[model samples]
Target: MTSMIQELTVSHNPFDMTPTMNYSNTTDSSFTNNSSTITNNQSYDGVDDFLLPWWQQTVFFLALIAILIIASGGNLIVIWIVLAHKRMRTVTNYFLVNLAIADFLISVLNMPFTFLFLLYQNWWFGTFFCKFSCFISPCTISVSVLTFMAIAIDRYMAILYPLRPRIPRRHVIAAIAVIWIISIALSLPNLIFFTTVEQSGVTLCTYTWSLDKDLAYNYLLLILNYIFPLLTLTITYSRVGIELWGSQAIGEETSVQHDRVKSKRKVVKMMIVVVIIFAVCWLPMHLYFLLSNHHPAVTKLDYIQQIYIVFFLMAMSNSMYNPIIYCWMNSRFREGFIRVFCWCPCRPCKKFRSKLRFRRTLFPTSVNAMSEKYSERNGSLMHTMTEYVDPDVNGPRRVSNNRNIVRKSDDYL
Candidate 1:
């Protein structure tokens, strides 16, 4: 009788309604048949039928749990190593410390909820957690991404302009502060826009902004998360590769070819691998979100389901991969990991002894031997000159004359 019921009847599947309907005024057989037809055409919610099993949930959560263990433990170690080791306290390392902090926060905040959300298949967390969790997710991600970009830019500056003054400590601190400020600003939208809803008796937490708003948010998210960062990382790393490889090809005599140089070159290669992985792992998800801006019709059931699964898996996978990247590709991170896990035996005492040993061994007996040789040669030349002059200019050479000269010098003093 009404447009709402008419639209609902047209949109939903038939044969899902209850059998009893009190059409008390319908006496005509045609009206009774129309009432029966309308009753048969009603449909109830179908989300319960579509719910996935626990194991069928995002595989990314399992991966995220594993990474959480490692990242929590690994990042703590990095923080300790960077703080304890004076060598790691440079301006660049300060940025690294912030990056580690960001990673740690992500693991602490994002990974556990991810596992729980996947297990439940719907938001079991209350309204507070739903909004808080969603809000923190974007913040953590933004911090991580922006930190990586900052590190890339720092590396580029270090390589491209080595002679320039080191980035000031104050500036590094200021940059980190700015990053947090911007990250919070980006995440602010989630707190405002995300909501929990009860649709057909199933309560769910989702970003329920309309198509236009979601598109704008998605486009901004993609730009912040992927496009600009990917572009900067790609170009900077490309230039770094060219610069380092070009140096390797220069005249060997002019260069200090050593294992240390080779090790740094290897580090550059590893950084490139990290950048590539960052791009490859995250690009598709961003592209999907970006294309979602078009608000394509989801009339096909399969397409909607597939999109949901793909994005869910993509997000889960993204959260789990960062620590693996750090461990697999970064030697500094590996070393910090070892120290963090207390793998080095008696590290503090060993470090002290190592410094003492280095100080003792730095200069050897060869240096003293050269000094002795020079002294002997100078004394012999003086003796030969004295021998040549004494017989012609003086009366005779005598031991008593040398004793008399010493006595005269003592009396004068």
Candidate 2:
């Protein structure tokens, strides 16, 4: 949160990152080591004001820790799954890689720092980090939303005109570079203006911009990061939805065509779900800021801090969902996760082995054992036999000959 949150001292919205015009008591101590009482005004009760009950605080800490572990671990595996595998190097997966990178960066940097910033009511890290933290927050968010928009457009192009040549890997590389450039450009103001300011007796990391300027930039963020992307996705995905489900499959009802149509539907549905989640998670935060800004008196509500915590958690949580969603919806990703788990001796994925056993298509060394048991079982190929695993192809005993056909998605999805 920026110094705008500093206004929380006098019964204001403590979590508001928009900075307000203010004077400081201490000289610039951003780079220099100063032990002043550092706190972000996002908390009405400053650093010394740890008035919340222990139970209430415990829930918040636990939630933050959960987010840190899940976001980091999940996104790390997603990155590995895409980069480490050859067949997974598809157009959409590349965009997913960028999305995962942004989330990973946020998970590692934003979650812990923000949690500590709230709990201790102090900025333990130095001034450089103060600015870096604020900059990276918006930058990563922009990267995510922008990447989502790009996916929508790419899907629009690929589906609406299937025969058209898709963007090459090199151009996608350039597009990724451009996404970061725009994100950095949009967030550069935060890097420049947000610094640690010692106000009254407490130090806060904030921006010193006047009210109009600060709110104007915030409005930009709201539009570019939330509103515009939402509109774009709605339009593009609407057309994509029409193209995919609006018409029947172009062939006689057969297993192959049904599978192709189903795969296409699955990919579209997965992307739509991801877009929906992005909208749901960030909507509250944007609405909260708008509500507080328009009606300043709202901040005086007794449970306002509690309200902000929920919105903040939802926003922070946006970073962690992409990986789980990928593994849940995409077949290749699920297999890759299983592979990673198999390699690790500790077998962190053991807990979820039962869940993954059904859909995943795995190559086990115990094929002979499975073949021997195949005669005993009825239609079980993988789960009951415990040899070949692919949850998607749960149909009649998957004839081994058609295995390659199921793995490829670019053909239809």
Q: Among these predicted structures, which one has the highest lDDT? A: 2
Full-model lDDT for every candidate: 0.49, 0.65
For each candidate, C-alpha RMSD in Å? 18.6, 10.2
Query: 1-413, model 2: which lDDT tens digit per residue?
Result: 23333333221222233222132333332311111122333543443553456898899889888888889889989888777765566678889899999999877876677666555545667789878877888889889989998888887887676656878889989999999999999999888977777665655666756546766777788888888889988999999888777866433444433554456567778888988888898778777676666665555566665666667787788888888888898866787777767868676555444322224344434546333332111122223332232235322223233242223333221
Per-residue lDDT for 411 in model 2?
28
TM-score of each model, in listed order = 0.65, 0.76
What lDDT, from 0 to 1, does candidate 2 have? 0.65
Q: What lDDT does model 1 reach? A: 0.49
Backbone clash count, each prediction separately: 0, 12
- Tens-digit lDDT string for candidate 1 (1-413): 53222111111101100111111223232231111122222332343434455565555456556667766766676667667755345555676678678667756765576445433335566677767767776687677778778777776776566445657778988999999999989888777766665544444555545635644665677677667878878888888767756654322321112332343455556556655665665655555443432332322233343344444444534444554555565554555554454655665422323210102112122433213221111122112111101111111111221222211000000
Q: Identify the candidate with maximal TM-score.
A: 2
